[model samples]
Target chain A: MTTMADRTDATTTVPTEKLTLARALTLGMRTALRHDPSVLLMGEDIGRLGGVFRVTDGLQAEFGPDRVVDTPLAESGIVGTAIGLAMRGYRPVCEIQFDGFVFPAFDQITTMLAKLHARSLGRITVPVVIRIPYGGGIGAVEHHSESPEVLFAHTAGLRVVSPATPADAYTMIQEAIASPDPVIFLEPKGRYWDKAEVALTPYGTPGAGLDKARVVRPGADLTVVAYGPTVHTALRAAEVAAEEGTSLEVIDLRTISPLDHDTVVESVRGTGRCVVVHEAAVSHGVGAEVAARVTEECFFELEAPVLRVGGYHTPYPPSRLEHHYLPSVDRLLDAVDRAMAV
Target chain B: MTQPDVLDTVQLLTPEGTRVADHRYDPRVAHLDPAALRELYADMVLTRRFDTEATALQRQGELGLFTPSLGQEGAQVGSAHALAPQDYVFPAYREHGVLHVRGLDLTDVLKQFRGVDHGGWDPAEHRVHLFTLVVGAHPLHAVGYAMGVQRDGDVATGDPNRDTAVIAYFGDGATSQGDVSEALTFAAVNQAPVVFFVQNNQWAISVPTSGQTRVPLVQRGVGFGIPSVQVDGNDPLACYAVTAEALDRARNGGGPTFIEAVTYRMGAHTTSDDPLRYRDAAEVAAWRAKDPIDRLRRYLADAGELPQQFLDDLDARAEELAVHVRDTVHAMTPPPAESMFDHVYATPHSLVDAERAWFRDYESALEDGSVR
Candidate 1:
């Protein structure tokens, strides 16, 4: 119901609206579809049902059935066809219903979608975007609430990115769609309802981009790195740390596959301490990669061993134990305290 | 387990060098004159020669691997020849006959086998996608591509050159794959202008077609609500007629069709596979007697359609291609080590760029004798 940006140019003053992350993503997809005729949306219930999370609420009616297709309930078919559609010059934005549901299409994603560009010797470019509502929170059970970003990040051909804020959700979706390579767009389902004043401008912002890591809050002591759902937890921990006279620099790694190594390395080089946080399991997750990179790049500048705060190396537990399973403000603070102790 | 008759499968040209008339599909291949039939015969012969040369190359350590389509040339060429220039093809790795029909350079295909490249030709230029090694995955791609063609308003355009269709080539083994089933469902629901060409070549490595399916593979398509048919895969005319009818129906917006070409694999699944361990020699001999090329050759020779000059010219062409494949493969070298870092992503990634820079430095250091 909120009126998105009416302005066409950068200089025109655009109004900011308080929007949920889900609404922001809907508006982002709408903006992209309006701008490019080639961009279309495909998924199970994305058309008339507006997606389970309602991320694609009204775009289907506006764009017509051809542009916003409600595909048959098959994950591998959704991704495999998207690859084919990409080959035929249509940039398809596919919505995988949930994070765990993406496994059905994992073979198509990891083998065909990821490797086509490289194996074809740069002859083919699949500008396809797979939007997965990821991360565990809420009261949902099993496949509905899961964090599967790291599974895709390990693949070379895919550009894996997760947006933290409503504004980021708005812009990053368009950026992911515009990318020539296939992208795994992980939307933090936990933060889908979180509201923020989003600048309803066109895709790319001057200073803020999709691939780079943004240093959200600056400090002189230790640095906290997180993405997607955990970024909020990291900020809350930073706020508490600030009141406690402990200056904690918080960096939101918008893109995970590329890692924004320069920004993380630069921040760690300056702060001399770093703690990586995520909602995925602790071992061999994003935290492990960040820790290894940080150690290799800033080993001499370290004040302590790089710490990681995340869920245990077990399947995401039931709702009753989810809070303990997921990285939280208290868990992040605990990691901070340990790093400070070192 | 009885031998299927004309009531079960479409047989246009019998293995004994005779043409069988069918009211429904006879019109489909009516345009193929004697010259066209000879050309189709030449394509099959050339495909077999290329397969033989590639197999020899693999044995000689020139190729890393080779997937031979020794007996399925009739199924492959017939289906491929039915395609329009605008029509796209998604082929399994063994579709050398389809590749030949699409006018792809055999030497370029050898690049993949020789380990010089993963895929050698530009798919866009030829309207043929790169060979898919993964079983049953490409059928979904074909359906998706057909969906794209539909969106482009290229279907049912009434203009032969404007309207387009897509064909996906997979085997009986791929029918059991979940992706293939999904592709059939999507194609039928969307009425995407695509054809599912299943070359039921009797085996998927060590397993027979019976292991992959309980009923006829054609019935698999019918179960998904797509129109399905069975054809004599050893008869090139039947393969062509059935595929042409399906493609026409697709281009005209009649929806998808599934054609199961019943055939046999005269060779092992690949160069590394030995058929002597799995199947009976008597079965091989029976299928060998029904050789697709021999069927066409006998038909042409008996019908006074085969000229001595044409046969000599065709033989020379096949030999020349074999020599070219051998010479090109023998001269191939591994691509530059730095090239490994290329094309991982179309856009630049910091990690790949950093690794490439490090590799360059390491190689230079080695050249300068600074480090090993």
Candidate 2:
């Protein structure tokens, strides 16, 4: 049970393991808990039930009850108490069950956790990590599939990041836990089962390129920016566009708040065209920020104005209509076509 | 009409300067001698003087606003006095007496109200957190902190100095808030060492207690499986006795206790409010008759503990404190504009850093006539 602590900074020769994004997160938290005696996990039904999505499976049996707490069914209480625990020198990782249900704790997250360090003039640091399962591809009912990441990224005091692959999940969760600032860790619930080879040993420090953008595919015709669930769609679009003799590059924005604008600008400078994709509504969403920044920095290099592919400006429709609501590969390719035509 | 009375309101001293005894709590405060009682009186008087001075400062446009703790001194000071130095305090906005008892400087309280900084005090140094303006939000933090104390092996320890507890001060209106109820649930389940002290000052701005809760606020705690008691907030000795017992229970790992200090808001909610717009003059007059400072003064004078020299010296000290607060507030200056960009995040944030750099360049441009 405690053996995970000794394996954290061990040799990097550990074989890569094929694991789901959810399992990678559990392993990351397990590694953090074992490495730092001060780290603890708290959320509703996180102990015996192993969380509704089984993201925290088998943790309680391993770490016992105190370190892996099953808190009361109160979102505000979970985050509020995590702030206090952070104040008491404990790094608490809190799990808000769903993205839509996170509004109940929004005041605590935006007002207290985000602003406490600044309010106290650096005398107090709330090193709390809020893990929210976000995005809309699961075909679940309302409140289960929604993207509320933009609301948190808009807040100045929080560090917002989402992992699109199992490998990123394995490392980013630990990075969020080790951060001195409060972090909003948005796990793409849509991509929870996405499998990838994750390194079992420490690869880098917490902040070493954890927030930087990654160029997933390289080309010269156009640049397509995406994150979380949309990253996969953009890659698919690039593959389809390649068959038609159009060279499209794809970039994954891992961090949302302190956006990696440098990478996006550099890619667009070469491609001379840009398209941003996301699952959230197109109005005032992450795509808007990406489009605006691309136009600001790559204005002279762009052949066409940056276009966006995302959900329409309406509430998340029923699960039956989700296929139409979510941004798909065909829709992203259509935006790439528009950028290339201009 | 006045608020309805609860039959179980604890009272160790009456408004007419008479002392009452209860077997359960009387022993808790029986150790206090004449000197200690006079000190308690002095605390209440000085706290009231500070509130009065702050209110005047707001009127004279020296401060943006002030939340006066004029009538709830007994509730704030007595319970605050019961806390050990190791115990932490999470206070609401109107806890001037608690801040005074916790050794927070009077000028530090004015910093936030004067539109300077959010709060200038170091919470770790004083073990008292910044005042939470959002009602009912901080009790959960207090509960979480107490859970941390329990995990640190600081609870139920026979060593008195090592064992610690946390107290969260809120008001009656906060009981309706979901966060406060959740705090009670967490504290009860974790068996955390905490005391939920609700100062039922009978008004949340213009709304009365009836608007907030149907039953007494004390009964609200019992529904959450916590032992609760109501005390006369005007009686300093009763407030002290009840709070001391609760703190001892919490430190000994007996779980949380909710104490409802039934008090009044003799002044407006803040310097910006006009209480006369909603309440009758008769209601204000009735509460004034139960003035906490006058009742304590009468009890001391009756017991021959308050000599003429003591009274003269106390008045002089109160006047001296008022002068010091006024001078300190006047002398205060706003911080540099660039300092606002500091401490947003402990780690370097690229967005904030870029904005700060741009602002510095902009300020330089203005000075050098580049932008113009």
Candidate 3:
């Protein structure tokens, strides 16, 4: 009998039949609209304009004006009114247009949307999904490239999700739209054009639900955990480590919330060490949580302390300094060596 | 007999209570009967009682802070009572009277103030939305709701049942916000069924109305092409009449109207504020002379609507309400620390998930000093 792994991942994986992260997201959103009648796509210039990135380019023609709404240029209005629509039984997916522009909506999201469900004692479920293209890479001017996940992660009653691979992007978005709770789907603009082989089968049938994590590459030496653009860097570093006879395990944490901790713990349990990485600053970033959790879950199982390799404690640097800002192949390889030494 | 009515700025019977009336523009006030007048009085007093009790609890370290609507009672209740059962209300932080009139429990307001929760009532249940601490954001919500009402086949023609008007309540300071202007423009252009109610309570936390606006506020609403009206907000009768008329017009598919309810602030802006530091004593005294509750009581007595026993009974009822509110506030308990991690996401967060795990290690380390 052919094993499940051989039958699915390695043998079934095809490179040419792949989708870009942006295209995958577009396809996933289109599929959701086709399925759920209540699902609406609304934001500044999302209708006839098709979004600043063309992420919603053809949606208006397919779904019509009411569902694919073009709202006034007000972020707070978009989010605040989306809450009202959710109250009236519409699954509103709001687009904040840009990262810097999202601040106007912060009060509504943090003070209102995040607390709406709990304040109602779960009597009312506000299942709004706010899609914001976040993080820096395009050498864009101020505000457009901020990694503001920490501000929102601190807020209760919200779900945060980000996808690094085209496959995960395709599947996680549909899952976020179908989710019962409010979700902030942060799409990495820097990785939108990046492509990878994405299995067309439903995630559970082919992989896991959007909320769960996936071990993209398996090994036994040490675990490297990362999400978004950093996942590619981790994979590249693993290849170099393999040449040196080091077996490094790699994990792609697609969902920022409800982390697939069991997988990380299992990896650490097997390898006896771990490395956490992200594009966000190391202080209070996603890796900090991973380091803490691995330390707690597999403290005895861990031979060395859980190490984090990420952006330094500062604003996203100029393009010249981005090489230093991001966790590069050298950075990931360095972290791997450190973990093994530990 | 020395009557306070002639000299009072806070006249209970007005739209020209001094009887110096310009008949064409003067509003009608005879609609309020003995029972209606009494009900309005009870609502104002009870709301004030609720406000005082909440503030006392906050001072006793039970709440984070309190936003008192002490002097704006007549405006809140007057407009709230005028609203139809189907008409919606969007309020700013100081709408404690609106909450009381709509039957929202005092504890619901406390949830937001105490930092225990954001808001504690169903907006659909009361047609009273959560109090917006962020200025002027909710008017757009009201405008959008009105737009939704328009899309729901609930506007135009002469059908009363086909129209559902939305009422947005804000303060003088909120008038300066971009969201408020955007809301007004949308309401006007769509001819959306909405009521823009601005409670000009003399001060926006020490910055008086003069600093906020150059023109009369009601006239400012008119610039957006919305029909505007000014009311003697200290007079409950005037408030009820003006709000009722505006709501009726909007419900009849007449589009949006703006009402600037000119009123005063009887107390400091909030628990952490001191009004004496900001404004002169004479100005505060001048506003006090127009106190809505006291003037209403004088009218009630002059009209033979109240016996001596009714006064005593009301006092006892207000005190009882105050005690109940105090006890409920004191009864509030802190939520478990895990609940913070629990509600952050509808789905679990990997970062939160990981951090929660890390926190566990720190907690355990503190407990037994086993994990370094």
lDDT string, candidate 2, B263-292, tens digits: 998999999999989999999889898988
lDDT of candidates 1 onward, in order: 0.91, 0.89, 0.78
For residue A105, give model 1's deviation from the true position in Å.
0.7
User: Can you tell me which runs of candidate 2 are displaced by over 4 Å?
Assistant: A1-12, A203-207, B1-7
- The docking quality of candidate 3, as DockQ, is 0.28
On lDDT, the leading prediction is 1
Task: Name the best candidate (by DockQ).
Answer: 1
lDDT of 1 at A189: 94
Model 3 segments more than 4 A misplaced = A1-18, A195-207, A303-305, A338-342, B1-35, B52-65, B107-118, B132-137, B143-148, B154-162, B176-193, B219-227, B248-256, B294-372
lDDT of candidate model 2 versus the reference: 0.89
Label model 1 with its docking quality class.
high
The order by descending TM-score is 1, 2, 3
What TM-score did chain B of candidate 2 earn? 0.97
What's the number of clashes in each of the models? 0, 0, 12
Residue A285's C-alpha lDDT in candidate 2?
87
Clashing residue pairs found in predicted model 1: none
